[model samples]
Target: MGRSGLPPGEDIIILLVEDNQGDVRLLEEAFHDASIANTLYIVNDGDEALDFVKQRNEYADVARPDLILLDWKLPTLSGEEVLKEIKSNSSLEQIPVIVLTGSEAQTDIITSYNNQANAYVPKPVDPDEFIDVIRTLENFWLSVVRFPTHTDED
Candidate 1:
């Protein structure tokens, strides 16, 4: 794990946009088991996730997350729509977004990358495999990758 009291430049904030309660709990458990210290924020739907990213309404004080884990299927707005909006906005485009979904459709995979998702991982149905996937994802994002820095302040 990164050092405690990370400088703003090193902070790893994750925004998770998922609607399934069980999956949310599983993700939380996975993070806990991994002993990661970074902050993780959860939103139940894509529209609200977009609002949070845009810093509207209740999200006005929220920090822009370094990474986003988005589900392809969401209420109100789809993840693809949210991804497009984020990539389209100059201020938000550089933030890495990982598509975390159960869909294995080739079209969804291609479209997610086409819409500028940084990565896509199909959700695993098996409990042990899901944990492994989460661990691998954590390792890749928090250890192996260097993400672009955000200079803007809202």
Candidate 2:
């Protein structure tokens, strides 16, 4: 195991469903700076995100992600809709989903929780603070929590 004590057998897969290119860059840089040993997949819209999750078409050979970082305001299927679909699916329900959004509205938070989002974090405006948020997320998910092991058959 590395610093997180996660299983050393493979790198964790993290899927980020975000439409903002700037935010994607920030998240990428932060993960690299934090030295997280994982694979990051990016999807520009909610439709693509769902496609990736369902392993349809181009994503047929893609590995299922261990964690998902979702943004609320998205093009095509809204993030709330995505969350509901994931939570309702028996095959996908076990995976942890963290909402990293700019909206701090109470309604958004409550709706996310009601849909079974594992955690909800508002995006930090400051670049450094955003990095800190990513680091904290990495620490908690990779070190403090135990994730279900996923195999090809899963």
Candidate 3:
């Protein structure tokens, strides 16, 4: 059971930070097909992602996500910046962040890891492959990892 008092693999929340509409739609479809009973929250830019995680402005009522799927390239803050902020903050650092990006560059991968991103996956061009990746990701992160119960604090 997690901090939420739910059994393992139940009621996990994920925050996806991606600006591309098409990619967002594809991820949504893929997550649905994966059949995981988890809530996915979407933020279109890095700035909004920060706000959501910080529980500020319009996001004060939302819960902290169990996982974060971040795109390295983003408007406003950039995923790298968001990752750094999350890792540096004591209240949010426990959540695992995965860098899901279109760039396969070695620099992007290294930078993401340096910033404490838990995993890096290049965005697959094929929809089917992307869905499979999501399924695998769900199986490992949600099923295998034991997350700390969330708390709201500085």
Ranking by lDDT: 2, 3, 1
Top TM-score prediction, candidate number: 2
Put down candidate 2 lDDT per residue, 64-142, tens digits, no spaces.
9889999999999889999999899988998899999999999999999999999999999998898899989998886
Better of 1 and 3 by TM-score: 3
Model 1 bad stretches (over 4 Å): 1-10, 152-154
lDDT of 3 by residue, 64-110 (tens): 88899999999999899999999999888988999999999999999
Q: Which pairs clash inside model 3?
A: none
Cα lDDT for residue 94, candidate 3: 83
lDDT of 1 by residue, 1-154 (tens): 2333235446578899999998999888877666545678999998899989999989988889878999999999999999999999988898889999999999999999999999999999998888889999988887677665555662
Supply candidate 2's per-residue lDDT for 105. 100
Cα error, candidate 1, residue 100 (Å): 0.6
